[model samples]
Target: MKTAAIRALPASATVFPILFMISTVHLLNDSMQSTVTALFPVLRESQHLSYGQIGLIAFMMNITASFLQPLVGWFADKKPRPYILPIGVCFTLLGVVMLALAPSFAMILLSVTAIGVGSAVFHPESSRVAYLAAGSNRGLAQSIFQVGGNIGSSLGPVMTALIFIPLGQKGVLLFVIAAVAGIVLQTVVARWYAAVGAAPKPKKAVAHDEKSALKLSAGKVRMSVGILILLVFSKHVYLSSFTSFYSLYLIDDFGVGKQQAQWYLFAFLVASAAGTFIGGPLADRFGRRNIIWLSILGTAPFSIALPYADPFWSAVLCICAGFVLSSAFSIIVVYAQELLPGKIGLVSGLFFGLAFGLGGLGSALLGEIADHTSISTVMHICAYLPLLGIFTLLLPKDAELRGR
Candidate 1:
């Protein structure tokens, strides 16, 4: 009977509509999340916030997501919850509403925590959807899913320049529309997910999956996972510097206006989005290990040059850094998924959680450094983070990952 049920499952195929729809929701979800950082300038001026306080705001949001995501993924792995998709966005909606009206720092922290909780729920499950929907084209599907987030995140600078700077904190109210749209779209995606969940999977495929997962020794698997986590730390901490402080760096160092600083940040983020879109197919063509090594390590030259460049050159170097650095994350996620073939939700949640956890921790620590030292010092220090990418050479080769 079990085998019969398993045999009833449909063969995997690239489901573009579901992938695109979930990608769209990712855009909405991340754009809403980006509002937190986008409002930093406004919040700083309006509330006379210290750099530490600013960092704490990001810490509160990201830490909440980080702690919760793995647990959420664990639970979903045991018992799939299709409706959790739209239900999670409801938390974000509530958070956004609270953020717009939040009058104090404590209130803002609470609001962002709610948004974080929403993110914790959203990512693991959505990634599982992408995995399910991906036939042989997992790379393209994950890229499609991730590029939405990169583009959505890119909007932060644009929102800072156009909305947050002008409208102040109240500008966050605009994202309420985005949250609502996410809920509606997630609902549509949920139905498909439920249907797919009820279908059958082939027994031979299940055996193959089990075999692939056991290809590496337990110690080897543990070591590889540890290496992957360190890579995530390197990638995200460096990125947190840009997302949380790059604009401030420009405003302070080069005497650029706030809006102008945001435009510079915007160029970097847009390049990141383009890189995310490009990275996956390249990985599919080349190999995950090669791309991961090149993508993370490749940014070293550009990043090392950024802190010393003139304002124009700073923007150019940042663009280069963002493009090269951004490509690694989706590839990393896909690679990790390959490493642990059957535990999709748990792996997704763990890595995404690590990304958030590391970024938030880095932001908080860097903010302190900036307060005691200078933003330039912070930039100078963070420039060396990419060099840690040299460790990627330790990861198992793509052929080994295929059990070759």
Candidate 2:
């Protein structure tokens, strides 16, 4: 089955138009979804919600997306669904509308679940689209796709500060336009995919031999996959602390206003967006393992320093932490695709699912810790997570192992 799917596709010429189109839709879709997190402080004030409850809200949305994504990808891999993209954006549109009018916490959860479902549908298919459009430059293609989401994620806090915070939750309604735009854009992309998505043009004979040389035993492949999953776990757990609670941390520790804290979060995420672009081209040249190692582990010093720094230094360290860590994800995704050539959709889904799931669980658990102990303490504890990058030693070197 996998072999058939691989053979159906011919390698493509790098399709810049399709890549840019999908990335634009990604920016729109994620900007809507991330707007929820950006509004957390306001939601807490409006509802008198606890930190634990806030964490649960993130958990609810992410877990919903997490649980469904792998299944969606697995199904799509077996049967390509070119038109599913627009349908997913419709779910996001509905979710945004519901969130704007949400009367109670229960309604908010339901709204986020809709949003999550949309995300679950969106990521795998969109990633596969990036894969199809990549041609020979897979790493750069994934980075181009990913940077849009990072930039969108950064925009959430800014949007919240400028729009939602001022106009109240109803400001979320304006983003419905973005969702509608996404549906239109994705529909066009769907048509493109229907024409060319599965057809990878034949490579030159030497390239074919290189592909054959890259084969690995099932056991080694599985082990590499496990290592990648662990890397995801480490990355997201640390990030969950920031995305879910960094605003609160700034408020508690530095006496910053909520809006100000959001700006800081925006800065960190923007740095992340910058880092995402850098990682891909570097990995394309230097080796994915080297970039992965540096991205996951190299941030440890800054992560450790962030908790103790004064407000200015804290923001600076956070930016450094975000930039260094952010590079790993695109590297990880493209590397995994290289690892399992035919299972692009399934691999994308699984890794993206694990990222959401682990981040959700980490948020939930860390929120409880903050409720009982202190946000400062939680930050101190999470700083140790990137040290797990020591395990990157376990990943097989693709260049070295290609012909073994």
Candidate 3:
């Protein structure tokens, strides 16, 4: 876990620790949030929220998390990441517990805040460690680390289903388990790093000096930023239309129930993880830009072709789409980080936080569009966004233009 270039921790130490750290934080959130959202309609009926209110609540949570990300990234650059981690885990644990016990709007709002707080805290710090782990081969290191995100995502609906059903209140116990587990993991990581014999680097912002402050050169920085935003737009549309809503289409059009759709989604996500795991390392082996563009092109037609399929074909296309989508997640992350090597935390926040935050917005917008237009149209439109991204990729090769 030491930052040194020579004699880095073996893969056993480097990969697993980073993976566990990133995955655990996301695992906690994903496990709980899915349950909360799936049950949201039922909860909303019981709670008597207006559509606006529900939308506002989601917006509140996201905006709160989104706004705080840059500052968190800045702080992570200066602080010991693990030191702050326990607190974030505790916040998630608190939020989940409060959510389980919640009886009123105020309480639920408070719980959402807790969830947002925990989420904001984790992204930047976790990315820092993952980047650190990739000391020599940052791409592979990030691929291993990025697996945590895909695993957590796949588990979200599954765990949520379990928590809400068979496990009942006990399944809700993931909160306590997550909190306690985090404490243990933190202790182990701390000790592991200690044994490796390096004081954890302080996370102070890379901007301490003017040169490194915005070390990214103006031209490359602008291009990279624009590319990320374009990619973000496409990503958001895919997530909203495919990741979140495709199942709904299956259910509505094909009479697939929540469980079946969820299972399919899980399969899609697993395929995606496989893609990312393979893609990142592959990009390193081949070329980052080439792989990235290839994934975009490869996935676009498949995703666009989704609405035309019957159930069986849809699942196949969905899973194929997953591979293409997953491949980009880690690659883009490493792509962003290398572009701003010294600003790993900030870059991670931009890649993950902004991309996802905007994606969430895209999700919401799609939901609203679903109200006025057919879900079919939304899916169709979603299909083309990624295609547009292919044009954006041609702007300048990310590798050639990074960090100015």
The best candidate in terms of lDDT: 1
Off by over 4 Å in 3: 1-21, 40-58, 79-81, 104-109, 165-171, 190-217, 395-404
Give the C-alpha lDDT of model 1: 0.89
Candidate that would win on TM-score:
1
TM-score of 1: 0.96
Worst 10 residues of 2 by lDDT: 1-10
- What tens digits encode model 2's per-residue C-alpha lDDT throughout 1-404? 23235335546557777788889998999899997888788898888888898898889889988998988888877777989999999999999999999989999989999999999999999999998888778788888999988998899779868987798888899998999899999998888887776444346744754575367777887888898898999899998999989889999888999889999999999999999989988988988998999999999999988999999998899999999999999889988877776677898898888998999899899999999999998899999889888778788885844454
lDDT, candidate 3, residue 329?
A: 65
Taking all chains together, the TM-score of candidate 2 against the true structure is: 0.94
Model 1, residue 147: what's the lDDT? Answer: 92
Residue 364 lDDT (model 3): 69
lDDT leaderboard ranking: 1, 2, 3
Q: Which stretches of candidate 2 lie over 4 Å from their true place?
A: 1-12, 199-215
The C-alpha lDDT values of all candidates are 0.89, 0.87, 0.65
Which has the better TM-score: candidate 1, or candidate 3?
1
Q: Superposing all C-alpha atoms, what RMSD in Å does each candidate have to the true structure?
A: 3.3, 4.2, 4.5
Candidate 1 lDDT for residue 139: 88
Q: Against the hidden reference, what TM-scores do the models get? A: 0.96, 0.94, 0.83
